[model samples]
Target: RVVGAAKDLPPEGKNYSKRYDSGEDVDRVLELNAGTVERDNINIGDNVVVENL
Candidate 1:
């Protein structure tokens, strides 16, 4: 799971949902675009972490 303040994720036709009453630390679930990931050459198990936006 991610830490720190949340930022606005890219709006590439993505979707989000909150299936449970998660605490402040854990809120919504983000769904990214598969095509975008593929195009970015991000493998199935790649470490696509970012910091400071």
Candidate 2:
């Protein structure tokens, strides 16, 4: 649910990496998706590829 919300947000820029905004924005994103992210074994500094559906 929360993760879906984050995905729905537009990407920060035109970069291929699909970066999100930083600082508080980044913190908020992580906060929202923390549960599912943790379940998937993803961690800070881990390399991840997010695809748009």
Candidate 3:
């Protein structure tokens, strides 16, 4: 289940997404390498939640 979707994320950094639906700036938001996730993949347009590491 998707928690939420944001056009922008916190912590400025590069973020990668399979889809480019989201116009989030690449300079901001930690980006995950393409294909880094498998089984269940999360794309740019997909909503997600960040938990405490």
lDDT of each: 0.44, 0.47, 0.47
Write candidate 2's Cα lDDT for 1-53 as tens digits: 13223434544475676554543334334333436665686555566565672
Sort the candidates on TM-score, descending order.
2, 3, 1
Q: How far is candidate 3 from the true structure (C-alpha RMSD, Å)?
A: 9.4
Which of candidates 1 and 3 reaches a greater lDDT?
A: 3
Task: Give per-residue CA lDDT, model 3, range 1-53, as digits (tens).
Answer: 23223444345458654454334344335454444444357554565576895
- lDDT per residue as tens, model 1, 1-53: 42222234455355564233324554434455546654675453344565574
Best by TM-score: 2
Give Cα distance to truth, residue 6, candidate 2, Å.
13
Relative to the true structure, candidate 1 has a C-alpha RMSD (angstroms) of 8.9
Candidate 3 deviant stretches above 4 angstroms: 1-28, 38-40
